[model samples]
Target: MDAVPLLRISRPHRLSEEVGAVLEKHIRSGEFGPGEKLPAEARLAEQFAVSRAVVREAIARLKADGLLESRQGSGVYVAQCLGAGVFRMAAGVRGEAHPIEDIFELRLIIEVAAAERAALRRTPADVEAIEAALARMDEAVALSADGVRADDDFHCAIASASGNPLIGRFVAFVSHEFSASRAPTWSREGIVRGLAGAAQDEHRAVHAAIVAGDPAAARRAARQHLLRAARRLGVVLAAPPGARGEDMDEETS
Candidate 1:
């Protein structure tokens, strides 16, 4: 009989990361179809030869990355395919020195429209989700500097409430972009505290407008929020080289 060689696999210190990688591979390979429910956690743990805690952590990470979704009393399912626009924004954040002004302008245009639509289309559940996100933002602000995450969550929730999956996906995409750019800025304690306060106020205004179903107010609030974000990035609004006034107005408008 011929001898079979044993394969050795490297063990990662973090079990969750290892599990996440395995699950991610399956997702990318299309082994799990879009919107397909994953097996129960216990079964997944057994199949992966890991603990349920590790499996749960892996699921949570994937969910954060907009790759998986969970339904109450149901199970985890693969997320729908995110459009190219969302992926393009996410792909642009790879150690490149992004122009903060340009990024803020893009965010302003997309998010304001998203807020307006959300105001017009949001359901009662969407309103509750936004309110919950607002509460989290307040909690994060009270707890201090790291509260910017809650602010991000609040905005992302509004994007999701727009009832347009692509909008939600784009929000998730740009979030990573903004985070990468702001990492240096947020490192300063003073900057963090100041931005946290500003974010809370902006989020409150947006939430109020959305709850009231006032699309115009929602758009204004969202636009103002992005403008504030641009200011924080120290970006000056200047005409693009060789562009005429009419051209600039047309582009921005």
Candidate 2:
């Protein structure tokens, strides 16, 4: 009798993550239909050329995502795929560059509105909160650090100052994706000391407009900030792996 062929399980890092990704791929591609029972853990282990423990771990991950259900005295089955948008957003963004632009596009609408509203509604306390966030960023930059968290705080502060709890919550919801997008760009060449300086200045401009109670200027500043950010990220994406370079730099941003 001939033995069945097992797939490769290469990639030495985060075995459970890879396992969950493979299972997610199968589920997404309909290899396992809705409500259909998955193969036994032992069978899955053989198919993936991994131990039952790894398979068990991956199943646990899927269950956490509400993708699978384990019934008493029975095997695991696929859950009905409801709230798919919730699932898509809930799948935390990590180390990937594809979703950055989409996230930025969403930010434009929300952030522009927030900036305009902040200009109209900002109080003494709101200004203080924003300035404190800026101060943190300044300290980070002076010490040559990643100010990504402060950057997030600055934006969220603006959302809060807009006087709408809904806007603040919306920004918070999309923030994980936004931060994931920034991680790669912030690590790019010319980012820490070069473009970061520009970003700091841009943020100051937005703050100034908000403080001066100029809604139009705040809106323009916020819009321009995102445009510059997108350009900078593109420069980073063009760079080669492990090479701090951005080729095709003719179209200067």
Candidate 3:
């Protein structure tokens, strides 16, 4: 009988992520090639010096991500990875590789600059597009429905208004990534009173600055809006994506 392969985690900080990363690395490296069964939870728990619960959570994450699979009564096995190599080289999970704070920081840099450029370059058509998108976003937020798609349209319109396909494309990509990690942001805890109204006001400010062709004000408004949004999201991100945080209970109601 052959012994099960197991690896030890180095740093204990962010245990589930560390464990997940290690396992991910293994599957990606072909050490546990496609269709190879992974060691049982008990053995993995012993190797990592973590509890079975943590191991279960880590495995569950991989399975949810389409990286691994569990058969009926059989152990877990690696999934047939198609773009595994590209994904490994490109980026990691937003919640795991980098804190959600970095996502907001990225928006502060790219979206704010996009607004500034849009103010200088926006044509009549672009302005009209942005205005329409903003109106839809306002309605969606007011209804307390998930405004993520409308919010995306509003930001992407700004990028398109900049008259740069590259900027628009990049903004589109970033928007997808950001929402992938933090969709339905309006539903998070500690969102504060009238969050929808506040966000609408900020969007209007950005739109007004662009419409007035005031590049500086456009940048400033975009900055202030992202800063407020980051603060609210920071609360949600106090926990990892899809999990609850300690402080959330007080703010939940």
Candidate 2 least-lDDT 10 residues: 243-252
Candidate 1 achieves a global lDDT of: 0.73
Name every residue pair that clashes in candidate 1.
Answer: none
Against the hidden true structure, what lDDT does model 2 obtain? Answer: 0.75
After superposition, which runs of candidate 3 have C-alpha atoms over 4 Å from their true positions? 1-97, 180-184, 188-192, 235-253
Q: Per-residue lDDT for 1-253 in model 3, tens only? A: 9998889769656788889989988875559887789999999999999999889989988887667888998988887541232232124644455556767767767898999999999999889889988888777665666676677778888998998877875675456555543363555331335665677889999999999999989988887787667665554323234533423442242
Q: How does each model score on TM-score?
A: 0.58, 0.55, 0.54
Query: Candidates 1 and 2: which is better by lDDT?
Result: 2
Best candidate, TM-score = 1
Ranking by lDDT: 2, 3, 1
lDDT string, candidate 1, 90-191, tens digits: 336664654666677677668889999999989897788788877875775565545445556566778888999878767766665655444533444634
RMSD in Å for all candidates:
13.1, 17.5, 17.1
Candidate 1 segments exceeding 4 Å error: 1-94, 181-193, 238-253
List per-prediction Cα lDDT, in the order shown. Answer: 0.73, 0.75, 0.74
- Maximum-lDDT candidate: 2
- Name the lDDT value of residue 120 in candidate 1: 92
Tell me the spans in candidate 2 whose CA falls farther than 4 Å from its real position. Answer: 1-98, 188-193, 235-253
The number of clashing residue pairs in each candidate reads: 0, 0, 0
